[model samples]
Target: MLRIGVLVSGGGTNLQAIIDAISNGKITNAEIVTVVGSRPGIYALERAKLNNIPSIVISRKAFNSLEEHDTAVCEHMKYCDVDLIVMAGYLSIVGDKLINEFNNKIINIHPSLIPSFCGPGFYGLKVHEAALERGVKITGATVHIVNEVCDGGPILLQKAVEVKPGDTPEVLQKRVMEEAEWEILPKAIDLIANGKI
Candidate 1:
């Protein structure tokens, strides 16, 4: 079984999806061992609690430097014996120590197709806004390897949702999020479970 660890920074919609998928046997040979959040007072922790999963809140505010924060987080992961790291809306720019330790064992789901609307400052609703502004007919999600750079990883899977004629960022995002991301994330997790990752 793959011992999975999830990192989140905000409301854990994706995290909930993964948990639901695992419970329903949509993904086999995997279990979430721990859930870590970069900050406190988010729905992610509550979700973990509801599911009876162990969770931790590592405050970056408590650490003076990025290296210190990374050390603290990685230490927790090591303690839990996590085999894989999944970034489910984790906001921090992961530093080198964690990347080096996990390497290709880490996976992240981006809100855009990547190599298009991805970078340090692009995330959440901004990605959808950019895609609509660019007049792209289709914009969706991509699950990829987590590299040192933000969203600059080799693609694993992508699913596109067509941009409707009268779509706003809000509408398009809701559609894509419902039709694409909810399924793609689980598919990515299954790939890892079956030695495809």
Candidate 2:
């Protein structure tokens, strides 16, 4: 089985999607071995608890340095014996230790189609706000390998969502999550787990 370790920061709606997919057998040959939150008491941790999955918080603020935090995160994943690491809305910027340890084994679901409204300073509702500000009718989500460069990894999957008229950032964010992120993230995980990618 492909053992997965999920990393999250906020509400974990993407984490929920992965959980649902696994439970429904949409993602075969894979199991969520653990869930790591960037901070304590996030809703993502609650979701992990509800699913009875092993979880822990490794808040960067608690560590003296970024390297220390990254090492802690890496150590936990290694302890879990995770075959894959999924960044499902994890907001923290990972350091070289974790990136080098996991390498291409790490994957992330970005809020945008990427190469646009992505990279540094683009996340959460910020991506949608930028899309609206630019008046882009086509905005979407991307599932990509996690690399040292933020969101610069090879794209595994992308699904476009229409940006409707008078759409607020929150509305577009919800639509993108429902139509693209929810669909492609799980599909990408299945592909990786099955060695199809």
Candidate 3:
């Protein structure tokens, strides 16, 4: 079985989806070995606990530099013997140390269909707000490899959700997560674990 490690921040709704998918046998040939949160007291940690998965909190504020924080996180992953890394709403930017070590073994879930509202400065509700401001009728999610260049990694999967006429940023964010992000993130992990990607 592929030993997986999840990096998360905030509510970890995607992490919850992944745990549910694995339990339901939708995500095969892998098991979550650990859940690492950038900060403590986040719902992602709680989700990991509820599922009986091992978890740790590596405080971003504790380190004086981003590189230090990423090195510590990568150390934990190595100790856990994780074969794959998944970023399921992990907001912190990992440094080159982790990127070079994991290479194409890491994957991230972005809130929008790539090349649209993705890359530096586009995240959370801001991405949805941009799509709304631009009046894009279709907005969705993308799963991509975690290269050193932020969201510039090659795409693995994408599913579009139509933006309704009266949609607000919050509403669109919810719809996209439900219709796209939650579905594809786990599928992408399964694909990697099963050698489909």
Candidate 4:
């Protein structure tokens, strides 16, 4: 089976989606071998433990320099023999070292449609807030190859979630995340695992 690693920084809802996909046989020919987090208290890591998967905590504050931190994450991926690195709510910006090492093997899920409300200073609730403020008729999630720049990689898959009337940022966000992520992220992973990418 193709071994994969996941990096998470928050609640791991995306991680859970992947797990559900795997359990439901949506992603064939692969399994998530390891999971790493920047902090200890995250539910993502806890979920990994419950599944008996190997997990690690690499703190951004532990390293004296950014390069060191990147190196540490890269080393962990290498140690796990990770064939692919999935970024699910992972907050830290990966350095060029790790990006270069993984190349197109690393993938990320962004909350908003790229080339729109993306790049630095945009994540999670921030993306939803910006989408609501801009009055975008449609907004959703994107799964793409990870590169040195934030959300700058080539798009592998995208699904648009329509903006409904009287939608608060929170409500719109929940709807979009549910509609887009469960479909797109698994499809991207399956494509890569099947050598279709």
Best by lDDT: 2
Which one wins by lDDT: 2 or 4?
A: 2
- Residue-pair clash count for candidate 4: 0
Q: What lDDT does the true structure give each of the candidates?
A: 0.90, 0.94, 0.93, 0.90
**Superposition TM-score, candidate 1 onto the true structure:** 0.97
Give the alpha carbon lDDT tens digit for every residue of 14-132 in model 1: 99989999999998999999999988899999999999999999988889999999989888888999999999989987888899988898899888887879987889889989998
Positional deviation of 16 in candidate 1, in angstroms?
A: 0.7
> Which regions of candidate 2 are displaced past 4 Å?
none
Better of 2 and 4 by TM-score: 2
Root-mean-square deviation (CA) per prediction: 1.0, 0.6, 0.7, 0.9
Candidate 3 per-residue C-alpha lDDT over 1-197 given as tens digits, one digit per residue, 9 for 90 to 100? 98999999999899999999999999999999999998999999999998999999998899999989989999999999999999999999988999899888899999898999988989899999999999999999999998989799999999999999999999999999999999999999998889998
Can you give the TM-score per candidate against the true fold? 0.97, 0.99, 0.98, 0.97
Among all windows of 10 consecutive residues in model 2, the one with the lowest summed lDDT is 110-119
Candidate 4 lDDT tens digits, 1-197: 77899999988888888888888989988899999998889999988988788899999999999999999999999988999999988998899989999998899999888988999999988999999899999998999899877899999999999999899988987897799987888888888888888
Model 3 poorest ten-residue lDDT run:
94-103
lDDT of 4 at 146: 90
The CA lDDT at 26 in model 4 is: 91
Candidate order (TM-score) = 2, 3, 4, 1
lDDT of 2 by residue, 4-35 (tens): 99999999999999999999999989999999
